[model samples]
Target: MKQYDKKMIVKKSNELIDAGFELSLNESRLILYCVAQILPKQPIKPDEMYFVDAKNFSELFHLDIAGVYKTLKNAMHKLGDRWATVIDKNGDPKEIRWIISRQYFENQGVLGIQFHPEMLPYVSALKKHFTQYDIKFISRMKSSYGIPIYELLTKRRDLKEQTFTIDVLKRKLKLEGRYSAWRDFKRYVIEPAMNDLNNEFGEFDATYKTVKEGRAIVAVTFHYKPRNKSIPLFDKQGNPSSEAPQKRWEEYGYRSAFEFREALELSETHEFDLTDAKEFLKARGKPANK
Candidate 1:
């Protein structure tokens, strides 16, 4: 678990990013921490246990040790109860748990998670068309909506634009009823989240403009532009997110970048990003190309 930067990376397919799920800041922190722990290029499995150690959570997120035990103990149950609604390959809306099981040892402050088999394609072995960001960027962000908004825009960085219908955005953020007024949504949700993204990100500027109809705000478009700073191919955590890899392959061994199909369960064809081959090569104990 001890890697560079002491940072946690949350990499997920764009589908999961746009899926309808609402998690509080604590819940987001707990799940994201576990997702980042997935060893690089090692595909996730439904039965594989992913754990969130309260001590690890405390150190990474700058939370008090005592408080993390209590906070995460509570968030553990709530997160287990959460399920995401996503559109399936047949264009059907399906409700699926990103996590299929949650277990915690009494008084240990360690919570274990099992990724729903349905989510392996989205959260693991990502090489392309996925959103990769260090959770530390929003670790301390107080806005409940900031993390989701950050992801919605982060995934579209290649296109530099993401537009969402007002209704659709709300459902994705799980903000349908709250922030009932345009100003409230803008001031509380949009603006604050934009600030969080801008502050944590480097070599990028985040901006937004509202689309209105006869004084009614109907949609919102987020824009990203590169800044002058030069970034590296990988982060302090050794996460190679700066480089644009090819689109992800739908099935393992169904494509060339990954040869260990037997290592993962076969998934549906409607998938996409295969991250760099270095980690996969490294896992096989082969000398990766420079």
Candidate 2:
């Protein structure tokens, strides 16, 4: 069986992060991992049915075959029973379930999931206002808070800075009563999550500061960007490496690699090797480029 070299997920952060739904750590990781495999390659079709082989789940999640089936079985049930809230015409929140229908072919190692038709607007095309990240970025992430924080940061990837009020942050993280004390939340949740994201999660490095209003901590502000190490100065061919080009494509919201290449072709300086151009652009960003 072929294994994925790299997996990617593209989702509108609002739906995944702001839906106010809860899932077990295992379920959350599994669902997002599965979604990465099933999402359309390009020109997303709203009515399309997405399928994932159980083997793919097992391999991706590093679980045994039987474990994959059992976990997915339970995960699907939870997903079916849960609801996501969306604002209705009256400006009130309305709840909708995610699973329109599902089928598990245990014998064939395949599972088919059809999302509710209503979710297409949030998950389809997603030409704008979407977050795209590679699964490798979170492969080592384990804490429940890790993925959500990662999503929150990635949503503002182009921004130089973003802040979340302490209360609002807890609300978004669904830890309303779990960590009543700011000290406990910071000691147990915030610190560890930040460490995991910076050290284990791929390329991006995030650092945050807590803001205080008088004696109380009011907000948390994060400064995030791709790691300087991940952006290689040059490849062996003396060409700009993939990292910078990929980052530019991501920042510009190019959905597909082909589109990014095509855009480069249409530029007036198309004849120049993009590698040199990329290096030149980087030089412009700094006082000096060694």
Best by lDDT: 1
Estimate, for each residue in 1-290, the C-alpha lDDT of model 2 and write its tens digit: 34545435444535555655556656666567655644422444556667767776666655567677777777787778766665565877767777677788888877777778776666654433455566667666767777778778765555647898877777666567887778898987798778768864455777899899998888888887766322222222323234445355555555544444433422212223344445334433444211
| 92: Cα error in model 2, Å | 4.0
lDDT of each: 0.67, 0.61
Name the weakest run of 10 consecutive residues (lDDT summed) in model 2. 229-238
Question: Candidate 1: where is the Cα deviation over 4 Å?
Answer: 1-4, 106-108, 200-204, 226-290
The C-alpha stretches of model 2 lying farther than 4 A from their native spots are 1-3, 13-16, 37-47, 63-66, 86-91, 228-290
Backbone clashes, candidate 1? 8
